[model samples]
Target chain A: MSQAVPSAQRTSLAVPTQVALAGVFAALIAVCSMLPPIPVGGFGVPITLQTFAVMLTGLILGARLGFLSVLLYLVVGLAGLPVFSGFNAGIGVLAGPSAGYLLAFPLAAGLAGALSTVVLRRGQAAAARGAGRMGFGWWALVWLCAMVASFVFIHPMGIAGMMLALDLDLATALGADMVFWPGDVVKNVLATAVAATVIRAFPALALRRF
Target chain B: MNLLDHRPGTSPVHRAPLGVKYAVLLVLTVVLVAWRQPVVVGAVLAGVFGLYLLARLPGEFLAPWRRGWPLLAFAGVARFASGVFGPVPLSPLDALGPALVVMAAVFGALAAARLLVITTPGTELLDGLAHFFGAFRRFGVNPEAAALAVNVMLRTIPWVGAAVRAHAEALASRGLRRGPVRLMGPVLVATVGHARATGEALAARGLPAAPEPKHPGPDYTRGA
Candidate 1:
């Protein structure tokens, strides 16, 4: 059953390929960040598609590239490309109220990628035990991992940033951040579905050390 | 597809070395953000305007601000309301002044950053950054790879934007009302596919594995 796995899945990518993938995903993240926000329920921070893009990058690109891609996006935005939410850019945006959330992007991507890799390895092991193609189960695990990563990394860092910038107590900051939960669930689900589809289409999509 | 804010020009701002311009921009932004006084903020705004003129930016360069008008209005209105109706009330006049000053500082900072973007081409800016980070190469960091990544990112941004628009339209035409959300899967698949193809192309070009060092100055370890 292990022999049934595609050769591409086991093969490692060249360094250039890894770098290019990271760059491309970084560009995608920037584009997503720059998209006009969809105002949700009058919260000052509008719902942007950036988180979804970050998660997708993580799941598809794997840990190292996922982290690099997001970090690159932040660097580009800070370098003044108007790539931040609402087309605002520069170091000030990073230093401003949303700084925590901004800073957490790379960490969120890293955690998501790491968790996905762990789940994927487990799925492969199961496949080696004569289990059928690790199809829906793999995707479900990916979704769960992405959600957990978001909960652990993105939200906490974001709330902390909000507290500092807004001068709100932890409870107040959490309350303000709570409005994003429902929307984030939808975004994470969408990202997982997209990533799963991409991986299924290209068995060698995820990054592996060369 | 026109993702870059830089416009082709021969103004002093364009001619100035990237480092000097960026250094000035950084210092100015720091000062603007640090000084909350109306006078300081106003002076910074005026100085930014002067630089804008010197940079020879077209009226269209300011077009990005139109998007912020509603936010600016909301900020003003919200500030006024809070001052008048809060537990410790204040005169509308007092509240309005602070709100306007805050708004002005924000606008000034944004304009200053935009000016930097508008005058600097992406490649030059990245090269400048790569040079700045080249100092870290001694610590086993590959600044060249980082620079290449940034270059690829800058070049690919417009392509990604176009892909999103094309994907969204394709979905809409297929009767998917929520095109953007529905767009996620297809776009990701397409983007990954494109990246793979790009990677293959770059490999095919036989680009050297190690980029040549920009400044191969004195090799002390090599008996220099």
Candidate 2:
């Protein structure tokens, strides 16, 4: 324990810190999905704050760590923790139509994160030193990142999965997929706003690369 | 099944090493992917279910099906509609027949994993994973880091619950009220604080909590 290791004082996060950050975000994703306050419950409908947490994870953590975080959550849930949306878990969910979207989470988080670093203009060299304010334009771009990841990757994959698992045609799956659009947009906004606020409060949290 | 739902047992399955159970799960997944024959997959499903009962667990062996019925019903209806209305007009039974077999294979894999979790203690599972990951030390991976993260996650779940309650009460006293937006902001802030604290703790314990700078800072490379 006495070895300072000299790595702790670096501008970038240490390896254990990075891993811990990812784990924290993964837990956050699980808590949001399984939140009792807004339980999706047994309705089997997919809308929940989980997506918000997932988006926030990307916006705050950036690509590599973001993907790692969500992937960790997925692995844990698959290991049988009832950590998925609506408090459901296990590999059985893979058989469900939403399995595609569930599987697409890490990719979506990574893509959103890849876009956020550019959109936020956070530097690669050093962590932001103090509280920093982001403009509405920045928030919009981050929102766009989350939204694009959701619509472009996660939703389409979900539709394709439903098509395969449920044997539905493209048109039918598209209709079902549309139901999530409005809730998702609102969620993306909340996630973006929260991410902006967190960064504002702690500029170092604005997602700089190691 | 939930981790909290684990029931202790002395059955061979329960007594088996996690490595053995994990290997079985891996083999099932690899075989399922490599083969398409429903009969082969279905046979494996039967064996897993039989093992579940043989272990005397406290639930229906068909619990996966029961939990997934809404999805099952929805798929059945959708396939039926497509069969009758599509231009090609195939029989509903014919369409659903293939999907069911495939989905069952998928769930069977899940159930097998669940059985492993249900029979094993959480710590044992974590230890098994830590051991498994330890072999990759040459690859720059810290196996214990992952297991530690999971430990923090499970431990922090209770903290999340407490934070929500405290935040709600504080918000109510000030007449600020609580909605997803207001509620989420502070909760996230708290969780972030939690992360920072955990990072600091890990660092103090001499774990690599922060990454090394690509270009060393002045103090970083100073020699004795």
lDDT string for model 2 (A148-204, tens) is: 999878899999877766557777678778867777887898998888777766666
TM agreement with the true structure for every prediction: 0.80, 0.80
Residue pairs of candidate 1 with colliding backbone atoms: none
What DockQ number belongs to candidate 2?
0.36
The candidate that wins on TM-score is 2
Q: Give me the displacement of residue B149 in model 1, in angstroms.
A: 2.4
Q: What lDDT does the true structure give each of the candidates? A: 0.73, 0.73
Per-residue lDDT over B1-224 for candidate 1, one digit per residue giving the tens place of the 0 to 100 score: 25565687999988899878778878876776567688998998888888888877757445546855554454345445545555566798877776676567556766777788778887777777778668878886578677777777777888888988898788778887754446777787788787777778777875315756688877788763
For candidate 1, what is the total of clashing residue pairs? Answer: 0
For candidate 2, the share of real interface contacts preserved is: 0.40
lDDT of 2 at A182: 76
Candidate 1 regions with alpha-carbon error over 4 angstroms: A1-12, A38-46, A95-97, A127-130, A135-140, A160-176, A206-210, B7-12, B32-39, B56-64, B70-101, B165-182, B211-224
Q: Interface-residue RMSD per candidate? A: 3.4, 3.1
Q: fnat, candidate 1?
A: 0.43
TM-score of chain A of 1: 0.87
Every candidate's DockQ is 0.40, 0.36
